[model samples]
Target: MLKLRKLNAYYGTSHIIHDLDLDVRKGEIFCILGRNGVGKTTLLRSLLGIDTRTRGSIELDGVDISEAPTYKRAQFGIGYVPQGREIVPGLNVLENILLGCNARSDGRRDVPPLVWTLFPFLKEHLTRRGTNLSGGQQQQLAIARALATDPRVLVLDEPTEGIQPNVVADIEKAIVSLNRDHGLTVILVEQKIRFARTAAQRFVILEKGRVAAAGAAAELSNELVRKHMSL
Candidate 1:
């Protein structure tokens, strides 16, 4: 339920994303795939209105949010789990997740039940400092924080990157469960081809700030991956 048309993004006149167009259908996992420096993160920043100037239209559920500020975008139901899991250092686990409640329109400040259900460990460690967590726990904390926003669409950048293998599987399972069970629409930027293939219903590969290839996940063949994503 997110659409981008003729979208271009820049960092102080250095254009990063060209006239990229994409549509993320409701309740599906849509992956953005590309090698490094191909504008995947830039596109996400553009969508979030974070540190980037963008042109063209970004429509969410048929309402044009192209000009909306970052907080407004979040209030409009887009939850962002940025790369590096930028959890607040001073905030405790519960406090960090509650930070997302600031974006909620409903005026509720408590953590969403879904967060507790998805991450039971968080409940036991609610008083622990967020940044003191392990890498995998920090990623889960980031995702939990986003979920607390009561989002319709969840956007994640490289959710599994740099995590241990076992924890990677947990995060992957959580992503899939978030979509399959909860009906949350997901827009994911990921480098892992296997997870993208398995978890995404559709995907786009970017090159030089534009879409190089896009289709149903089944159409993402070895040849296409080699041509566009292989190092």
Candidate 2:
């Protein structure tokens, strides 16, 4: 239930996302696929009102949020797990997760039950420092923290990038479960084509900051990957 129209994003006059138009339906996983430097991360930042400056319309459930601040967007039901995970270095696992509660409209500090259910490991290590965890564990912690916001739309940028192969599968499975079983809308910026094809209901391939190809997951063919995403 998110829509973007004519979205142009910039980082200090270096234009990134260019007049992009996209739609993410309710309770579905929508993948954004592109090679490095194609503005995938910039687009996510634009949606979240992060560093990049943006122009045009961003609508969440029919209400315009183009001018809303990052926290306001989060309060409006967009949860972000950034590209690097960006786990707060000094915070314990529980404390890091509780940080997301600041975005909650209700202003509750309690972590949602869903976060524990999806990542039971987090519960056991609630006292552990977030930065002390493994890469995959930190990624899980990031996702768990985002879930603590109780967002209607989960926006993840490269959730499995550089993750251990064993843990990558777990991350993929969690994303699928979140969309299919938990009824959450996911906007995923993913590098892994195989996982994207299997988990996403629809996808768009970006080139030079704009949609080059977009269709159902089944249409993410070998030819398309070779054309838009091959190194």
Candidate 3:
């Protein structure tokens, strides 16, 4: 449902991403992988129109969105959960989730019961302050907040960055549910190889701001991983 072509981005004259092109098919999880500082985040920013210095075409479905603002992109069904799980520290869990409703067109809003059913811990912590929750809980909150928007496509940047194994398992299960059960399109930008295997149906590896490798996830071999992502 998302497509980008010949994408170029600059950060104050330091050209970071160049000539990037990829597509996230509807009802599939497509991953963009690269080492640190290789412009994965820049690509995500370009898609969201967060980088004013970007040059290229970004489209949701068939509509051009290169010049669209961040809110407009969100309105176009691009829900983003950034790398850091940027939840409000002072807001209670329910309050934090309510902010996601701003992306919706209708005034009447509701969080899907499945959201709480998936993360029952959040139900108990509804009135609890965000700052009081542990890191994993905060990560769950971030995902919940994005899901609260009920977007057609979900863009998640490094969802497992600092999460523990069990929590990561839960998040992965949630993603699978969203994909297979709900048919949400996903654009996952991540560096974790093991986790990458779990979510990605196709792979696009970026290096020095360009696509160096891409294919069916099942086709990614040990040699490819070694050359492109090994530390």
Whole-structure CA lDDT of model 2: 0.95
What's the TM for model 3? 0.96
**Per-model TM against the reference:** 0.99, 0.99, 0.96
Task: For residues 1-231, write the lDDT of model 2, one tens digit per residue.
Answer: 899999999999899999999999999999999999999999999999999999999999999999999999999999999999999989999999999999999979998988888889999999999999999999999999899899999999999988999999889989899998899999999988889999999999999999999999999999999999999
**Model 2 alpha-carbon drift over 4 Å, by segment:** none
Steric clash pairs (candidate 3)? none
As for model 2, its CA RMSD to the true structure in angstroms is 0.6
C-alpha RMSD in Å of predicted model 3 compared with the true structure: 1.2
Residues 1-231 of candidate 3: C-alpha lDDT, one tens digit per residue: 778888899988999989788888899989889888899898887788775488888888899988877888888788888888999978999988888878875654778676897789998889999878877788889888888887889889988789877788888888778887888888898777776776789989999999999998887778888998887
Question: Alpha carbon lDDT of residue 105, candidate 2?
Answer: 96
Model 1: per-residue Cα lDDT over 56-124, one tens digit each: 999998999999999999999999999999999899999999999999998899988888888898999
